[model samples]
Target chain A: MNGDLSALPGIVALTLGVGAVATAAMLAPAVALGFCLARGNFRGKALVQALVAVPMVLPPVAVGFALLILLGRNGPLAFVWSALDIDLVFSWWAAVIAAAVVGFPLLTRACEQAFGEVDVRFEQVARSLGLGPLRSFFAVTLPLARRGVLYGSLLAFTRALGEFGATALVAGIIPGRTETLALGIYSRVQLGDESGALALCAASFAIALIAMLVAEGWLRRSRP
Target chain B: MSQRTSRIRCHIDRPGFSLDVDVGWDERVAVVFGPSGSGKSTLFEIVLGLERCAGAHIRIGGSTFDDEAAGLYLPTECRDLGWVPQSPTLFPHLSVSENLDFGRARAADRDPAARKRAIEVLEIGDLLGRSIDQLSGGEAQRVAIARALASGPSALLLDEPLAALDLPLRARVLPYLMRVRDQLDLPILYITHDPDEAQLIGDIIVVLDAGRIVASGAPRDVLWSRAVLPLSEALGLENVFEGGIRREHGSPTFVSNAGLQLVLPVSLDGDTRVRIGLRAEDVVLAADRPGKISARNVLESRVIACDDRDGDVYVSLDAGEKLVAKVTAAAAAQLALAPGSTVYAIVKAQALRRLG
Candidate 1:
């Protein structure tokens, strides 16, 4: 049992590192898409919205397969893939990419709701005060919607921490290399190592609980 | 100060309603008088470039912000104008001083002296540290006005800034607006549905109804015009008149511009121009002259229009001065009232209220 669980610390570090990186990388695109979905009026808006929600509703394995076909080594991106001469499959970056795709819809939906709650009048007032539209959005709208954005990021972080099917297919559970907590637990359970699987589950619960607590505290502090 | 003019010619189409207006004004304070849903706010939005209306031509101080025929359009940020909506929309995440600084920092021709004067005029010096949520309605409006002034705008547009406050708070904030109009050199466009507010602050008045300008002139002239009288009457400024004060029979009498006279209970020491108001329900119309009456003023009038409300009749009378009398339909029928019929308007001394 001890020998099997020796990789627990490595798994924890990998999960935390990949989760944080994925959350950070997803923030900008999520915010932009959220604002557009909430405030913009243009053609193909519904199509864009549906595309964003695809990963959340579709099977995680299916999402991973779709990503594999697009970014895999001899795929349609073969020119750039050969130019870079780098393997994206079975790498830590693959885990980050899978986690980001799975968590994006949740983050964007939360952020869209948040931006929708902010009154457009505040932005108008900012523009009237001589700030341009983009500046007004950054200065007035974003700060006012800070709590929502923070909560969405935390949700995305938690979701990234538990990503299983996509990470398993894309990164392929290499011990001490790309294995996260979920993949480690799955590997232990498949190998009939009940104690190791239970320990990994406990760690996952703790991380999720901490993320929720921080989100709640942030929401409380931001309440006007 | 050199005279400046604002010219606006716009046509906006909305669902179920459209606004088409062309007007110009050089007054220091121009009041856009209209009822709710009169496209007053839409007019402001078009001028501020918040709403797009094609073929619109807007020029202020010789600068063309929007001339659609020439295909030139300026965004709201590029326009040299400040706006205060009906609600005091202070940024909730900021303090009062930060809100004021927001305007000052972005102004192209930022004026520190003007900002300091605005702070002094609005008397918001002590509220600089308070958060936005801590302010009362009146205080928030004062801060909003001062913040707009800090931007050093060439013109200011206020969309019923006092409409959110109660009567006492509105009264408290109105004087600050008056001070801004009197002290500042910029033109101001104040939109309001209340006729009293229009009369009190308007140097020039433009009356709008159903998205069209029905009348435009001096406050007394436009507000008292036949087209605007019914709208003003609905807003509770019925029987409004501009009159000169005079002493007669040891009492003060008000002689109106239409050559009608009324004995007022209150005394004005010297001869001065004053506005007088009487409630529509307070004026009693009598078909026959009564022998013994305690009412102070009685004038011969002709019934011009009678409109049937729920159970009462709104009788518009021309007593040399326009007066509206709300009486029961039974009484109107009993008196056989119709257009061009003679009647006497009996107003008690206490019913006449002096407005500024």
Candidate 2:
């Protein structure tokens, strides 16, 4: 590796690309789960809530180990990949999955809080306005809670950028490919490259800080 | 005009409360009056289909929204009912124009004329460009109402739509409300706990108490009904007796309901539908009929029930119809009055103020 601007595009792509895909996965699943928890009335709601929060408390390595058993080539779900003729192990996609797993709780928790803070009166008013339940949610509930959704997205993105332990187990830092900024920092430190590790660490922190600031500012600007 | 023959029947069951009622409306405004936590908003929820209920049958203008027995149900979106809530809730992210357009776009009648008509009807054309956040509470409320009205709904359901405003702001919005009521043919279900608001706008009053409709009829009849004697005494309003005045004995005047005579100070005509005010404290009870007392009005009344609330004790008496009087516990003990006890009720004629 040389100190040249030629590799900047790949590095930028890695930074933005990993953040975007992993963040999207985290945001999508967590939001879906959040919506379910927020709106559903069932006997097992408390148990379901406990299940959603389990990933947040578990050790990152344990989470990676569990995923490895379910998703690895020799694991229980190996046939699923074989049937689809796809590769998941030791790939950039695996890194995205690991990052998403690490990031999902942040997104889901934020989304759940956002949805909870919403007043039920809005939905009632919408229904009384002649919109049905489904229409009311789309027309009023979703729009009113948009700020929270955005905040959750930003939180997920930051969490995804910082993922290390789970990605390390699932994807195993591969230079110029599966190597995320967090993984890159770890590798640099392991190889006794102090300057490189510090540089990457500072970059990652700056990215996360900027993301939080933007999200906070946007939410404040859009508050009802 | 079709609304005159139709009334809405709604049944709702919630935690700690349930409401079952069949209500119809004419061209006139029907105000649902009740105390706080009397399931007013919950009733609106069932009617609006925001909250689910079992065996609920609702109809507006003969259009069936829910028929549990028939297994027919129409969702809220198809119901086409406008709603105005107390809070001035407008979509914050959308400009007022977009918010107005949001409802119009979803409405089955999406004509430009309909959209324009809604803005004109609600009188919010000037606030179109402004964002929801920039609006004052009143402006936001107007926009919300306009957006709902844009849908071309069959009727309007208002859930304490003016409660969020202070008295002065409420006065400001009254004209617009009056205009809407006068100009539009739409039937409106106005819910309020305020007696003043009810008296101002209500043609028919449906009084709800503790999840049940206690009384419903013309506002005048319900307000001063002998059936609601207990409620009036509880409210500490001026209570009056309806009867004809009989011959005077000495300085005391007598008014008789049916054949039951009550003494008062005023001497008036013998046969007329007259109302007299007899304050709860002014009414003294005696176990036996009294003579030579300054109290002009006296009656033989049987105690119906007793309710001790706060500092005042309420004794409900049935003097043909019913009468409730608020007395101190000391006064109640002094009279030795309990349920099923017969007593003489005396009201001075001066207390018999005539009502129009």
Best by DockQ: 1
Cand. 1 TM to true fold = 0.84
Off by over 4 Å in 1: A1-5, B1-4, B238-356
| Model 2 lDDT tens row, B101-180 | 76664565633455677788778988899988888877777777788777777777777877887755765565566556
Q: What TM-score results for chain B in every one of the models?
A: 0.72, 0.62
Q: Interface RMSD in Å per candidate, to 1 decimal?
A: 1.2, 2.4
lDDT of 2 at B269: 37
What alpha-carbon RMSD in Å does predicted model 2 have with respect to the real structure? 10.3
User: What C-alpha lDDT, on a 0 to 100 scale, does residue A20 get in candidate 1?
Assistant: 94
Listed in order, the DockQ scores are: 0.52, 0.35
